[model samples]
Each structure stands twice: as C-alpha cells, then as structure tokens.
Target: MNNAIKDKVIEILSSIKSGVDFANEDQIVTGGILDSIDITEFITALEEEFDIEIGMEYMENENFDSVDAICEMVEELQEA
Candidate 1:
C-alpha cells in the first residue's frame, strides 16, 4: 500500500473521529468507530483529498475497515 495514501486516509479519518488509532485498527467499520454520518463526511473528504469520486459501489464496510484497505481503495480508484 502507498504510505502517502495511508497517511492521508488516517488524517481524514482522524479528523472525523479523534483518538482512534486508524493505522492499527482493522475493524473501524465493524467496531463502530465511524457512524453513517461520519462515513458520509469521510467519503466527501476523501473525494476532495484524492480527487476521486467514491461511488455507491465503493461504499462498503470492507473497503473502509482499515488504513490499508482504505489505501488500497484509493489506489484502485486513482488507477481508474
């Protein structure tokens, strides 16, 4: 995974919900670190930060579960 993407993702997530170790937390969605509203805000932030639109197809818990997963999704979207 890209370190830059990972760092940006962590920053974005932290902005939405503070005091959570996004880098080490693998169950962000399942563990309830972010709610529905936070997820919406996060997606918006990610779109602006990465210049990529996160469509409904990409809105899944597995996609946002961890920093690595988020980086992977961002990389995939960037490639597209």
Candidate 2:
C-alpha cells in the first residue's frame, strides 16, 4: 500500500469522523464507524481528493473498511 495514499485516506476519514484510529481499524464499515450519510460524504471527499470517480461498482463495504483497503482502491482508481 502507498503511504501517501494511506495518509491522505486517514486524513479524509478523520475529517469525516474524528477520534477513530482509521489506520488500525479494519472494520470501519462493518463496525459502524461510518453511517450511510457519512459514507456518502466520505465517497464525495475521496472522489474530490483523489480526482477519481468512485462508481457504484466500487462502492463496497470492503473497499472502505480500512486505511489499507481505501488506499488500495484509490491506487487502483488512480492507476486506471
């Protein structure tokens, strides 16, 4: 995973909801750290930050579950 992307993802996740250790939390979606509205906001933020459109196909719980997962998704999108 890219450290820069991971850092930015953590920053974005923090902006959405503070006080959560995004880096260590592997169950962000399954654990309920972010709700439906927050997920919507997070997707928007991610799209704006990474300059990549997160289509419905990429809107999976596993895609946003952890910092690594988020970084992986962003990197994949960026590469595309």
Candidate 3:
C-alpha cells in the first residue's frame, strides 16, 4: 500500500479509535474490525487526510466500503 494511503488510514483510525493499533496493515477496519460510527468518522478523516472533496458517489459501497477498498479509492482520487 502507498504511504499516503497507509498514513491516511492510520489518521482516520486514530480519530475514531483512540487506543486501537492501526500500524498493522492487515488489521481490519470493517466487519467486526470497527463499528459503524467509526466508519463515519473514518470517512470524514479521509476527506481531510487526502485534502480532496469527496461526494456521495465516493461514499458508496464501491469505495468507502472497506479499509482496503477505501485506500484504493483514495489513491485513485489522488491520482485523478
């Protein structure tokens, strides 16, 4: 994973979960890995992390659906 993606994921997780360790890339961030509320917080964090404006279209299951998926979407958006 890209450094920016990893950093952003870590940043987002930090805002949502104080004590949780997000340094491990394999650490899940969805489906029992984190709560729904945390997901919302993660989305917000991503918006700020990448310094890009995200719309509803990017917030769907195809993008902000999971940690890996979200990282991919962020990288794509950054590239674009």
Candidate 4:
C-alpha cells in the first residue's frame, strides 16, 4: 500500500475508540474502526492531501470502508 494512504489510515484510526490495529480489510471497516463523523473528516483530509474530489458514489462504506479500501480509492482517483 502507498505510504500516504497508509499514513492517513493510521491517522483516522488513532481517533477511534477501538484500537487501530487492522490486520485485515474486513476488520477495519466492520470492526468499527471508523464511524460517520470519522468518514467525513477523513474525506476532507483526503481531498486536501491528495487533491482529489470524492464524489457521492465514492462516499459509501463499501468504497471507503477500510484503510486498504480507502487506499485503493485514493489510488484510483489519483490515477484518473
């Protein structure tokens, strides 16, 4: 995974109640590593840092669910 994306995940995970030791993709998202507020804040930070706009379709948890998922999304947007 990209260092930037990984770092961002760690940043968001730091704020959550559960420990942010994501061993797998499902654990991070379904395990409640991030909530709605965290999502909004993360999107804002992502937009600012990566210079990409997260459209409505990309806002869903399925896309931004985990650190890996969000990293993939960022890579896709950056590639585009």
Q: Please give, for residues 6-36, the per-residue lDDT of candidate 2 as tens digits.
A: 8888998999899998889999999999998
- Rank by TM-score, highest first: 1, 2, 4, 3
Highest lDDT against the true fold, candidate: 1
Tens digit of per-residue lDDT, candidate 1, span 21-59: 898999999899998899999999999999998999998
lDDT of each: 0.92, 0.91, 0.66, 0.72
TM-score to true structure, per model:
0.96, 0.96, 0.61, 0.73
Across 9-49, the per-residue lDDT of candidate 3 in tens digits comes to 77777677777565653434334566667767676777776
Q: Which structure is stronger by TM-score: 1 or 2?
A: 1
Worst 10 residues of 2 by lDDT: 1-10
Off by over 4 Å in 4: 15-18, 23-29
Better of 2 and 3 by TM-score: 2
Question: Per-residue CA lDDT of candidate 4, range 1-80, in tens?
Answer: 78867786667556543565553556544556677877777778788878999999886767766677778888999999
Please say which candidate is ahead in lDDT: 2 or 3: 2
Q: Which model is ahead, 1 or 3, in terms of lDDT? A: 1
Better candidate by lDDT, 1 or 4: 1
lDDT measured at residue 56 in model 2 versus the true structure, 0 to 100: 95
Against the correct fold, how does model 2 do in TM-score?
Answer: 0.96
Instruction: Report per-prediction Cα RMSD to one decimal.
Output: 0.6, 0.7, 3.2, 2.4
Poorest 10 consecutive residues of model 4 by lDDT? 15-24
The 10 consecutive residues of candidate 3 with the worst lDDT sum are 24-33
